[model samples]
Target: MTEETRRKAALVGAFERGAATYEQLGVDFFGPPGVELVHRAGVRSGQRVLDVGCGRGAVLVPAARAVGATGRVVGIDLAPTMVELTRAEVRAAGLSQVQVELGDAESPALPPGEFDVVLGGFVVFLLSDPAAALRGYRRLLCPDGRIGMTTFASQDPRFTEAMQMLVGYLPADRRRSPTSEHDALFATAESTAVLLRETGYRDVHVTDAAFESRFRDVEHWSAWIWSHGARSLLEQIPARRLPEALAEVTPVVERARAVAGDLVFTTTVRFAVAVSPG
Candidate 1:
């Protein structure tokens, strides 16, 4: 298989395995950003919306509410487990306007110009070809339809150090963090805005929001890591090395502990929005 195909397969497997705990951890990491993404996307009542990589319905749930009963919200994910669980959650929440499907966020299989808004909450950077995905999103939107997404401007320094420290425990051939591979496209607000504009989007706007998430302790912090895309990295280390890996990462993480003892990390997120020039 091609490199991109292999990368996508691995990502799907990681997310499928992490479906249960993804964002279900006690930390408030995804929710705040999800809500902020929807609000910034300007989802209007009665509009048709498409939420790409709608893991656990973080963006889906709020967009559904924002669009009201008259609107339609279709969420797509590559992992069947995420799609299945999110479907159940939508039903349980009685969001009749939302539909969850097992599909690819990179290039959803739908007709062109069918949606009024398209949202990618902390998921665009994970795509195998983010620029191509942006182009596809433009095709999926109605005239002047908007697209809004969030990408990390910077991770907490301690979190970065801890992750870097974990890299030492991985086998020699598999010592790279998956996130590091795609950091350039999302390296800065101007860079992302330039990407959108180059891909035919207009009126690009980029803003930053800093979110602070606190974990009860070291174990809580470790579980939080395993609960999301970060698990991809942790899972690569040999099972036998996990304890030693944790032992090494602990002190680095502890340095971020608050006075009350909760581990705190502030992530700077960049929110970018633009209009399709139909």
Candidate 2:
């Protein structure tokens, strides 16, 4: 398989493993940029919308609501589990206009010109061929339609430290943190804007927002880590050294919660939006 395809597959695997815990800890608990991104993309009533890398309807569900009964909202994700989870949520919420399909966010092959707003949540950087995918999204938008997506500007400081601590303990070959792979994607809003413009988007704009993710204490913090995709780090721990690793990581957690009675993990998120020249 091609290297880019393999990277996409690994990303799908990571999300599949974390699908069940994603909404609560990863989206709501950690603050997914769905609602914010939807608004930025101008998802108005009666509009047809597509959410790339929908991830349990973080953006899809809200966009469905924004579009109301007259509009349609479709979501695509690489993981079957995420697709099924989003479908279930849509059913439970009685949102008949919302549909979730299993597809590669990197190259969603959905029909073109059907959507007025194409939104993505935490999708751009993870894409195997982001520029190609942006062009694909451009083709999917109706004339005058716009596209928007969120990428991480930075992760919480404590979370980064605890993550580094875990990676620091692992063998050299296994020392990479999951998020380290996409650090350059949203490093600067100007860079993100340049990408949109280069991909044939006009009136491109980038905005930033800070979101706080909180944990009651270390117990809650550890649970959140293990329950999410970050558990990949925990899984890498040598079975023999697991206990030692946990013990060593405790101080890092303790220091993180030192000042705040509740540990607040704050991250800066960047949203890039632009219009299809049509």
Candidate 3:
């Protein structure tokens, strides 16, 4: 398989393995950012929305609500489990206007110019070819349609240190985490905005916001990490070294403990919105 295909497959498999617990953990990690993405995209009633990498309906549900009954929302993800679970949630919520499907976020096989807005929440940097994906998303939009994506502007220092600490337990060949691998693409607001402009989008706007996620303690933090993409790194650490890894990461995270005893991390998320050229 081609390298990009291999990367996509690996991402699907990793997320499939964690789908059962993905975003199910009691943390406000994805929700706040997801909602903010929809709002920033200026989604409105009767508009069509496509949520790429719509994990657990985080962005899907809110976009659905924003569009209301007259509008339609389609959510696509590479992981079948993510699609299946998100569909179940959509059904449970009676969001008939929303549909979740198993499809690629990088290049969805849908007709061009069929959507009013496309939102990628914390999923752009994970793509094998983010620029290509952005260009494809622009093709999926109608003239003047907007696309909004969220990427990490900055992660908490404690969270960064703890992740690095965990990497020490990984085999030498696997020591680098995925976060480090994709950091450059969305490293700065200007860089990300330039990417959008280069990808044939116009009126690009990039903004940053801080969201606070809390964990009861180190154990809670562990569960939270395992439920999302961060699990990729944790999965690489040999099973025998899991305890050693966690033991070392705990103190680094504890350094962020709030006065009330909950471990708090303030993640700075960059939201970029741009309009499709006619």
Candidate 4:
């Protein structure tokens, strides 16, 4: 298989494996920022929207509401489980205008000149060819339509420290991120805006935003991290050593809380938007 094909498979595999936890932990935790991004893109009533990598209807549901019953919203994801979970939410919410389909970002089957807005939250950075994908998304918009995306500006410092502290528990060679098998993702606001302009978008702008995730204490923090992508780091420890590793990581969290609070984590993200020429 080609390198890009391999990269695409890895993205699907990682998210598919994390699908359950993502919906369980991510929907509520991530909803505000996702919704805020669509709002920044200026979604309105009677407009068609395309949410690329719509993980858990975080943005999809709000976009549907923004467009009201008169608009159409389609979400495409690389993981079937992710799309299915979001579709289930759509059904539960009675959003008949919202549809979820299984597809990759590299080639979302959306028709050109058909959508008024395309929003991708925490997704563009993961594409194997982000520039090419953005170029395609640009064509999907009608005259004067806009596209927006979100990327990590930085992780909460405590979380970053906690993660690093966890790495210290592992044996020497196995300490790197377990999720390294996936493609590299862009990680800053300025760089992302530059990419949008380079990919044929006009009037590009980047906005900085942050959201907080709280845990009652160290134990609560441990449980939450294991539920999502950070579980990759925990997987590096040997089965026998896992318990001991957790024991070691506990002190790190304790020290963090002393400096901060019982448990508060802040994730900073960048929301970048660019419009198609008329």
C-alpha TM-score for every candidate: 0.98, 0.91, 0.96, 0.86
Name the best candidate (by TM-score). 1
- Scored against the true structure, residue 174 in model 2 reaches a CA lDDT of 62
The per-model lDDT (C-alpha) reads: 0.90, 0.79, 0.89, 0.78
> What C-alpha lDDT, on a 0 to 100 scale, does residue 223 get in candidate 3?
86
lDDT of 4 by residue, 183-236 (tens): 233545666777788888899999888887666777777767765556656655
Q: For residues 133-228, write the lDDT of model 1, one tens digit per residue.
A: 999999999999999998988899999999888888878887866656777878888889989998899999999999999998889999989888
Report lDDT (Cα) of residue 82, candidate 4: 88
TM-score: the better of candidates 1 and 4: 1
TM-score of 4: 0.86
Q: For candidate 2, write residues 173-240 as lDDT tens digits.
A: 76765545555655689889888998899999898999877677777777677665676667667879
- Clashing residue pairs in candidate 1 (N, C-alpha, C atoms within 3 angstroms): none
* Model 3 lDDT-worst window of ten: 174-183
Indicate whether candidate 2 or candidate 4 has the larger TM-score.
Answer: 2
Pairs of colliding residues, candidate 2? none
- How far residue 210's Cα lies from its native spot in candidate 3, in Å, is 0.2
- The ten-residue window of minimal lDDT in model 1 covers 176-185
Worst 10 residues of 4 by lDDT: 178-187
Q: Which stretches of candidate 2 lie over 4 Å from their true place?
A: 25-32, 177-182, 258-260
- RMSD versus native structure for model 3: 1.3
Provide C-alpha RMSD values for all models, in order: 1.0, 2.2, 1.3, 3.2
